[model samples]
Target: MTTVQEQPVSTGGTPSVVLHAAEGLHDLIDGHGDENDRTGRIAEPVVEALYDIGAIGVFTPRELGGAEMTPRQAMDLFRTLSYADPSTGWVTMAMGLATGLAGAFFGENAARELFATPRLGIAGQGTRPGRAVPVPGGHRISGEWSFASGIKHCTHLHTAALDAETGQTRFFIVPVEQVTFIENWDVLGLRGTGSIDYTLEDCFVPIEYSYPSLSTEPVTGGDLYRIGIGNFASINHGGWVLGVGRRVLDELAAVVRAKAGRPGAQTDTVAFAEHFADAEVRLRAAKALLYEVWEEIEATLARGAEIPLRLHTLNRVALHNATFSVAGIAQFAYTSAGTDALRRGTMQRLFRDVHGGTQHVSSSPLVMQSAGRELAGLEEGKRWVHFSLK
Candidate 1:
């Protein structure tokens, strides 16, 4: 069993201090190293620390008793948390994004009830394989939703289902008590995420707790909710990949320096040095691109304008850049670190984490296809990223 240790929160300081404390949480986990690989035991301390410092609600609306930080702030926090443990960062990003989406898409009553607590972690599945049958005043939802991350600690859940009559897909919020947590998240990477399945059986969902997928109604009340769902999805996962990439580069640099004076280093000294320099350049270029996209997103949010198509395009570009950077760094690290990186160390773990980061649906090939289709003026099929512009 992994030993869990919660970091104490510091009071009476600037917001940067709070952020610094949050970053420190990552360092603490990184110090644990391989002990963090145990499934279902790694993220408790980190999640507790985040709850203690109120970092989990960074994207929740202020009116709902959350900080309602901007997308940039949310991304920074995820990146910092991810440097320590990708599972912890994945769960945090998943919960934070779901909370923000709940506030944006759900009815006011549902939002109030869900965000009433200080840290309400949510797990959701977007695939609408479930069925929502209309009852008198609500809907009877029944189906098994897979890939519900952080379900063990979640108080609320968001699930997508299709109406049998009209064939319209909708999202529903259900309490923890109403669903059963199934242990289905056994994987080689991100094992600590506890992304288990939840079984829903004749769950009665109130009318207010459900909304059509891709809400067309304007999110009038909260500025945080006004942000489009596609934009949120694009930006949230970008931070996760960026953090993993950063870790890969850091580990590569350390390993290269350690092996610099070895006999193996003498054969192709100039070529190896060039490879290290090239990796650094590529990593820096990726960071610059991520920052440029972030600045554009911030500017758009600052102006209170709807998410333009260009923002989605930029998000796609940012994710692609980060993914390629991570792959490049991983290749260099694995090659330069020789056989040592194959052992259970920082580089090995970082390699797994970086690959896992790229496998996320948001960062997958579909995003690239969507961007290409949009650029070519071709009609993209139904997608989760499609939010109605009202």
Candidate 2:
């Protein structure tokens, strides 16, 4: 088996500063993960550390004083952070994506004003479009959105609303304080994410702060933004699953080693050894496939060409495989570790986190089926438009 010290797919650029910062916070985040889980929010100290390390700005444009990491670098950063703590990684992923995309979509004046802070954090739901009535200077939006991850620590929100007049969906950037947060984040895992429900009542968002939902054209960034939000989010989810999967396996390995000297250890069997090797290979294969897809997309974007239908379809399938395959690996680790994973500890938390990851819309059965349709050439002249073949 290959060593666990695998490096992320590299696309020749300056080394990632965000990756180093994520590494530095590993111990701190892991230590407080339980506490953060209990509180249904990331511990204050951990949140502060994320902001101080500039991890929340991983995806924002370089010109806007954010990291603007390449897709590969961003994936590595997410994997590193998630390996430390899944909840922490999930929150950071939501905030970073929302903030960066908002900046990319908004006009220069709005982006300059909104992202002026070095530690800008954003959260909101892009699916489940709300209502937006056209007004004189802007649109008055009113609706509720669910699973606004990282909303507890965010400064602004990026919500989707359907324009009543134009019938087109648009994303409105609003201050977090303007919305009423519904305290209902109770769930099976990643509790520290605080992905609660939120509502806006007649919130007026200026035209400059709103952009079409499908617009890949960025006003403040480079080619990365041109890939659209769906593809960008896939990178984050893919990296997160890989990290959590690695953690589960690594924890199980440590447990097996610690019990090796004990008499008749459950994991001492030859069958368990073979199964462990299989799990490791599965995860490694998934990671390799994910990176391969991203690397090709990176090369394409660098050449100023639009992403082809095949690449987009492959991105979805790659993420589906990464997520589900990791969950399978986690199941193996948990079962092989026996009662050790059942107790309240890192192993248990990781098992829960990995399963929680499997429920994300990005890897839902419908999305997978959609990808399959594309790959089978069953949807001729149809292209993927946000998890669907249309």
Candidate 3:
């Protein structure tokens, strides 16, 4: 048995894995976030500590030693963790989402072995294109992938490629030893994610270890998997943005309160009060709509009905809203704090981190454009990142 022990993890009603993680995020987890940022890698103690909270199991099925959280539950977990720290939250989000997708894409035995350890998590780049040549039982994988978040502490790494023989995209499940970490994670913010590049050299992945990215349905059959990829992908993006925005607000509030007694601080305080209130309203509206769409997705899935167009519509709108809202919040906080905000390890980092989120391809405004086009009866079935992620 793995050192990561089992505990009932729920979202409040039963103290599910996400809730457990929420309650278990203590000083160690909180303090190490900055350490991870400063060092450009997550500390071993922090990784191990996450195991205790079942962070890796959020989307993993119970049969595979995972928590099998509903897609929405997993999003809530990411949001809560981001509230503690965005770097840890990004790592957790990458691990959970990648592992979950692996579970769905890989066959039972392969999935089982991958999730054999209670705390096992995978990391790799999915964005870069690679080439796979046919071999005896599998394919030879050779490619360089970038932005592999949390690769330093991951058990395995994953990538997708163009199959030479069939011309299909194949998922390559590779042991960490076969891949080389590039030590190129230097960044302005969200520095702790270890979002670096990795290369595979003549790596042979067995047939069982590889699968067509779109050929299979999730082995862990559920309403969550039944929901289309577009709907499922929106939650985590919104959650991360929401949490970071909340943190900006929380930190700015505390700073404003601390400076309330200072000479000439009241003017800034009054301005901050108004901006903060406005920022909260926007953030909450985005969050409320996000969850409301999520609930609709669950209901639609539960009723065995086709996922609604509105689900994707709401998802795209919420994602864009959250990203912009967080950007606005960071700006307000920065102006409110002025020179102190410009200092290192201050509002500046949060500003960079939130803007960094906007840099994500998924958070791109193009997503909303495609969704809008689809809503207007245009060709959009497989034109977006959702198809590739699925």
Candidate 4:
């Protein structure tokens, strides 16, 4: 339940803005690629550039003055941007998804009001590290969540807590100011995400500002919102990993070609050839799994039918498998490149980013296990996994 603002968001999103942002991202990746990765921060300039292109709030829905870009479009954008730099790609995906989640909760009118702010974006964690107590007009929420990506740039945070009165869970939209950000994001890869841990201490969230993340009745209705958030995140980030895999494969191919002409290079080429061919087969298979699942989900939605457990499980499998496959591909490329990649090149960074991105729970085998259990017509077994499916 969201309070409707009298002012409605304008309903218009020109494709040109997205296209421009894509091109700008390419240029930025080329110019600031290493800086972004090493610094582990998305600079203000890049944020400003994204804002100028109206690429910051893809979630708000066209009717609500947000881009309202479909999951397919956003995923493609994320993949393309990731080609230049995965860190930026990671941040972009998180921001876009956060915005979309907010749009899904904010209903129509409030969404417009929120997205109307220049350069507004959202980011937060799904895991509950605290509790929300029932209060006068709303719930007083206090919790800590880890791995909140792109928190440095978002306008709001989307979090959840167990209700003090009821064992049930509820989600909340908190203004960024209410969050106590803890700079604890050091990591092995995906450094640019700046995914620090954050805390919220008894922040009062009005009823209009909170809802269940898994609710069937979204305040705002659209094809995008109609698609459940779990499915949406699965496919959205799935595209990202596919793109990253493509980049790593392509970069390795270039290296192989460059080294082919060198004296005594045929041996390495032969080795790389084997690795590339094998990786190609695996990557293609993994990539296809994602699109197949995405298409089925869309078809189900188009038919106004419930998304079956099979589709959800398949989506989870594809996303996790794709991530695992890509990370393996990067590892193969790294081994093939050996000392060459070890010398700290783009391939090296891609190797690290791929590995880092896979660290997300979304890419974990636990998700795949849940999917397998569901497909086998068995219980989810794990309470946390079962809860997410709800």
Among the numbered candidates, top TM-score falls to 2
Comparing 1 with 2 on TM-score, the higher-scoring candidate is: 2
Query: Which residue pairs of candidate 2 clash?
Result: none
Estimate, for each residue in 299-388, the C-alpha lDDT of model 1 and write its tens digit.
876787766676667677677778767777887787777777788777777777677667766666777766676667575542335432
Instruction: Give the TM-score of each candidate.
Output: 0.86, 0.95, 0.90, 0.90
Query: Which consecutive 10 residues in model 2 have the weakest lDDT in total?
Result: 1-10
Q: 209-250, model 4: which lDDT tens digit per residue?
A: 777756655565466677666666665578778888998988
Q: Give the C-alpha miss distance for residue 387 in model 1, angstroms.
A: 10
* Model 2 error, position 167 (Å): 1.5
- Sort the predicted structures by lDDT, highest score first: 2, 4, 3, 1
Off by over 4 Å in 1: 1-18, 216-221, 266-268, 377-390
Instruction: Please report, in order, the local distance difference test score of every candidate based on alpha carbons.
Output: 0.69, 0.85, 0.72, 0.74
Q: What would the per-residue lDDT of candidate 3 be over residues 1-390, giving only the tens digit for each residue?
A: 112233223221222745665657756667776677789877788787666666766766554556667756777787888877788888877877677667665666666666665457787766556999998989898888888987888878878888998888877878887888889877877898889998887788998887666542566535566554445557667778888888888888888877877888853556657777898898898888888877787788789787656565666777787888788888888878777788876466778788778887776767777767766777545433452211
C-alpha lDDT (0 to 100) for residue 159 of candidate 4: 85
Full candidate order by TM-score, most accurate first = 2, 4, 3, 1
Number of the predicted model whose lDDT against the real structure is largest? 2
lDDT of 2 by residue, 1-390 (tens): 111122212121222666787798989999998998899999989999887777887887766667778788888988988998999999988888988787677777677777664457888999899999999999999999999989999888999999999899998989888999999988988888988999999999999989998988787768888898789767899989998998988999999998996788879999999999999999999999999999999999999898999999999989999998988888888898889989988998998888888888889899888888888888888877787888
Q: Evaluate model 3: give its lDDT.
A: 0.72
